[model samples]
Target: MPDRKKIAVIVAGGSGLRMGSTIPKQFMEIGGKPVLHHTINAFRHAYPDIRIVLVIPEAHSAYIAPLLVSFDAPPSITIVHGGETRFHSVKNGLATITEPAVVFVHDGVRALISPELVRRCCEGALAKGNAIPAIEVKDSLREVDDEGNLAVDRSRFRIIQTPQTFLSEQLLPAFGQPYDPLFTDEASVAERFGAEIHLVEGEERNIKITRPLDLAIAEVLLATNK
Candidate 1:
């Protein structure tokens, strides 16, 4: 098989409003390092020579250079200004990539993504054109229908996570269409343009840290991993 370049787009545009912090949630410290540090490092560990693009708010871009230096960020890392919404932010990150390669779009606050999971996403994408990581929902789920609430079968629904990997050709054209409110994640955006994506088993430990309790839980998970 011909070698394909690997690119990772790490979105760090979170405002931290939910976490009750002045800074973005991805900048919060966990285990004496920024949460984004753990996330970027995971991709670097998985694909040592991969090119990485980080998208963050313009106001927060200045702080990232020093933070990246402190962590010795991947040699090919690039920092770009984010847009008004998640869709636009992702567009800006995608703009940095200009090759026919596989790309992984990941949330910066998801600091617990393991190297093995990273490889699984990229390799899956290589074979399937696109790959989305998802895990079975373990909790009971409910939904409000037109008439009233209903207990939905949790077994039928899965909790989706990142990094969502895709072949650049399959992804770029799909993103060419105008953004929609329902485009909550990369997989949705891809599917919005009629692209078929495969789902890979996501690791249970892979979680997005948004609330204060989530950061605490991530701290414990990090300790356990060590």
Candidate 2:
């Protein structure tokens, strides 16, 4: 694995409408730094030499330089303009990978990703070809449909997280397939392309920052970790 390169395709294309902010949620401040700052930091913390491909909207490209400067981010980050959907954005990022390597597709807003979890995903992918981090569902669940809703077994389901790591041979070709709405994350894309999905233990604190409450939780977690 030492000879192989490690790359992270970070998707930060959210419009932030849900967060009710003019700035994209990924750029919003969290723990005295932007959400994306912490996200990229986590990967570097895990593997310093890992290459970064950051996908964001073309209009927001101007913000990247300043954000990087504010945190003194590494200059190795490759910035690409996002496409119409998550699937397309990821494909655009994947195009940057011309060689086979270990790739991680992550949500830029998930600022709480730890170095330990990132290493777990990397090791799993190296051994199994693909690794998706997930945790058990703790809340009650329901199956809703045209028929009345019914209780479903929460224990049977797991809540997925990132960075969804995979070998380049499997991950790059997976994105070459035609986009589908069901392609929610890298694991799904790889699975549809015939790669067996492997799950690794994920930290409960590795939560995506989507709302104000999530930011609060991140602050507390960051403080405690410090």
Candidate 3:
């Protein structure tokens, strides 16, 4: 990749309503450290030289700023205020990168993302212009039509995960366009501008901590990994 700058934008825009906690889900702890801490650490472990942009709610940045100093190896991270929506939050992060590089857009609550998986995503993005982590759907799925619910082929569908990597040249420009309701993730946004998204295998443990049960599962998973 010729020493290209690798950057990761971790989006922590969730409130704790689903988790039923007073704190945001990302600020909650899984294995001693906060979920956002673990997430940022994963990227640092994968690529020590990578720059990180954390897009979080402006109100929460004060809570996280001091906490970052506690990291054994504090990373090159910049905190950006999150926008109204996920797409806008990502756009806020993307705006910081004016140089050509490889960028990864990740979910802050997806703290279980491993160093190995991060490497795979970066490598895939270096080869192809973009790489999105995804796993095939394992459960039976049904589609609703005018007739009624009908069985759908699960094999054709994939459960997408993040640390969605892309060449900044492609991504930065793609975000320049106006937002659309269908721009669910970086891949969708890139696709809107006719950029191809390549898929890489994602670990099952790379789950987002949205609910109370999810944090418990992540604790167990983190312990198992250790």
Estimate, for each residue in 49-153, the C-alpha lDDT of model 2 and write its tens digit. Answer: 999999999999878976787566455789999999999999999999999899999999899899999999989998999889999999899999997899998
Per-residue CA lDDT of model 1 for 90-178, tens digit only, reads: 99999888878889999999999999999999889989899899999989988987899989889889899999999999998888889
In model 1, the clashing pairs are none
**Candidate ranking (TM-score, best to worst):** 3, 2, 1
Which RMSD values do the candidates have, in order? 1.4, 1.3, 1.2
Q: Top model by lDDT, which number?
A: 3
lDDT of candidate 2? 0.89
Estimate TM-scores for all models.
Answer: 0.96, 0.96, 0.96
lDDT tens readout by residue for model 3, 1-226:
5879889999999989999988888998877888888898889899888899999999886667655865886776888999989999999999999788889999999999999999999899989999999998999999998889999989999999999999998898899899898889999999989997799999899998999899999999999994
- What TM-score should be assigned to candidate 3? 0.96
Worst 10 residues of 1 by lDDT: 67-76
How well does model 1 score by local distance difference test?
Answer: 0.89
Q: In model 2, how large is the Cα lDDT of residue 100?
A: 82
Off by over 4 Å in 1: 72-74
lDDT of 3 at 20: 90
